[model samples]
Target: MLKIFKKYYGYQWLAAFMLGLVLPFIGKLLSVSGLHKVIWFYLIINGLYTLYLGYSVRKRGLSPLILFALPAVFSGISTLLLHLVSHQYGFYFGLMYIVLSLFTFFGDTRDDPDENQIPVENGFRDLKSETKNDGQVSVDGNLKV
Candidate 1:
């Protein structure tokens, strides 16, 4: 489980959202009972998380595609703020969440370790070794004869 979490931990919000979607009536109940404050707090946390996600993705050098996460961060903020006052902006938040989810689902954010692998045997293999003729010139004019 820890391994899976490390691999796909960024998708935790999606899992939470799915669970919330399945149990929306509880959220509605909380909202009606003046407990939206708690929900607002959670939304703030979500906002921070979305912001972190955006920044982390951008820091990972996944730019251009990383731009997609920015709106999600802003929308997470917008949702928290708007949910504090009214529910009219819920649709916008939903749209932004969908966008974030799509980005999370499809974006290739993983860095390839192979891309950074250094060759064990580069061309400069014998730089310290003295050649047979240090001052001799070759046909290609390589040495200082």
Candidate 2:
């Protein structure tokens, strides 16, 4: 499951964002107290997780600074907004999660293998040894193979 965990690290961020965005509503529906505390805890955990992933990718020469920064900033802003806005904006928060997810997906380049590392032999190959220089092979006399 570790492989799945690594692959969906971005999704984890989305889920955390969703949880933080909805917890207050859920708590209100259930008449539960301390919703803010729960949401804050969730945001804190997810924010730290994002930072960890960013650090890991950065260590591998992929700059995940923006990925980390945006979420960290959003977490603070959204938490504050959730408190100030009486009307729940969970849907908008979800939209923000999707936007963040897209950014994370597009921003990451570590998932792709280096093009320079691909072996030449594994690329286009000539059927005949003589025409290897031309990158095309000639057949029989009339066929120009």
Candidate 3:
């Protein structure tokens, strides 16, 4: 399970995203205002972390990180600002964050040739000739009889 988790960033992002999604519901169920605030804080922090991730990937020439990260950061900031301005736009900002995060999380940045320069599997096999005289295994894994 750890190996599987380590295989993709999407898994980590998904976990964070799900927590953000369920926290509000859980708060409502328990009638806890503190829990709701905590969830919102988590969402903001995660948004920042995701923005950092985009910058790192972009540094590696994976893709245009700004294209994705900008919107995500904007959405997060908007959410916070909505509290000061009006709660009417808060939901819209939250939706934008969700959409941007999902898109960036599942995006094909790693698939870019610039990012994945190493050839995973080359079809060409190493060629070597072996001569055998006695019953033994050769250096190249060839049997000599």
Candidate 4:
């Protein structure tokens, strides 16, 4: 699994780089600034997030730090390259991106107990469960259909 992820991880990098390349072009077209520019950047960042998220769901990939970090760096450079935002604005933009992406990624993930697994106090015991779709969970960890 690690090998598979290592092989495909480049895809995440490539997407971020491509996003950087494309964003300046899109900015040129829309000429967005002020609140709109922030919204635009946010949307783009989250769009990249979905790419990282897809891989994560399969348990076949690693962190979104690639998506978060690369795009922030590239977007900062892009502001320099394309003169999209002033230096001060660009700085804040990059900082916001890093903070927001990290928060977004970490905030959304969870390590809760599996809904299908029942809690056991003792060592082990035989148990059976049936469900009829009543949206309730029995003590032995079975769905009510």
Candidate 5:
């Protein structure tokens, strides 16, 4: 599964774009009575798409981070601004998606296994030492050679 994801993860965004284009009609069809219902459906679909985009990008180490993160950040802010202007609560779900994306972008370093790793030194010692000679301690609390 990881191998497949590593190879074809790029396709996920394109699929998401297509899915987004089709979501409004599906929402409209699902909501036969109320505009609010349709908007709510749209919000859920859009939020899921944003989450999918973030996850896909986070999973792809070879891909450029800016390509996904910039659009997501801008889209999230725009969605919030749009909701503010239009006074629609359904669109507020976009903010949640944005927060999810930000978390994935910053927190998910699992894509690159070595990124979080630190090499160990064979005989490393802390520079700050409490060693004293004749009750005279170093001013910086480190042993002076």
Candidate 6:
């Protein structure tokens, strides 16, 4: 479960978005209003998630570009779904979430520093040794933790 969480560490808000979509239908079975009161709850949860995402990305020295357009695209899809279903079900929350996500992501403008890329090697050998110009395998002298 933690592995899944780490793999999708930044996409937890999409779960909230999906739950918001399902809430109206779930309410019908529970004898509750079909999402009339849940919009605020949805926004609050996603807003908190957005705040954490913003803060963590800043602290981790990540590129804003990595987060750029992610919330926009998801919120855009949510907004489009809202347009399709809101009139039929009568709850509108997508616009405000989009605005909040836009504010959080757009305010971060720091460029990512250049990443040091490790050269890829494909071989059955367990040791990390590169072939020298003289066609002899030599161990990499540099050790990294």
Best by TM-score: 4
Instruction: Tell me the lDDT of candidate 6.
Output: 0.47
lDDT of 6 by residue, 9-33 (tens): 4454454444444443344446554
Badly placed stretches (over 4 Å) of model 2 are 1-26, 29-87, 114-145
**lDDT at 54, model 3:** 52
Which model is ahead, 2 or 5, in terms of TM-score?
Answer: 5
Compose the digit string of candidate 3's lDDT tens values, residues 1-145. Answer: 8776555545444544443444334444666665444445445654555555554454444444333433333344433432321245345545554555555555757665576454548733464437555466879999878
In model 4, which runs have C-alpha deviations exceeding 4 angstroms?
Answer: 1-8, 29-38, 41-61, 80-84, 108-122, 125-145
lDDT of each: 0.46, 0.48, 0.48, 0.57, 0.49, 0.47
Tens-digit lDDT string for candidate 4 (50-117): 54454453343355556464456455666677765556566665665555555545554444235357
CA RMSD per model (angstroms): 9.4, 9.9, 11.5, 10.1, 9.8, 11.6
Q: Tens-digit lDDT track for model 2 on 25-142?
A: 4555666545553455334444445545454554454444435433443355454665522324433443454454445445656655673464676765544465545443446434
Off by over 4 Å in 6: 1-5, 8-14, 34-39, 54-85, 88-92, 106-145
- Put down candidate 1 lDDT per residue, 16-96, tens digits, no spaces: 443333223345556544345335533554444555555454445444343334344334433454333234544554455
Which of the predicted structures, 4 or 6, would earn the higher TM-score when compared with the native? 4
TM agreement with the true structure for every prediction: 0.35, 0.34, 0.32, 0.50, 0.43, 0.38
What lDDT does candidate 2 reach at residue 74? 39
Candidate 1 pairs with clashing backbones: none
Give a tens-digit lDDT track for model 5, residues 29-119: 5654445644454455555666656665666553644335423432443334333112253334445556655666566566666767555
The local lDDT score (0 to 100) that residue 94 gets in candidate 6 is 44
* Ranking 3 against 5 by TM-score, winner: 5
How well does candidate 1 match the true structure in TM-score terms?
A: 0.35
Q: Candidate 3: worst 10 consecutive residues by lDDT? A: 77-86
Reference-based TM-score, model 4: 0.50
Worst 10 residues of 4 by lDDT: 52-61
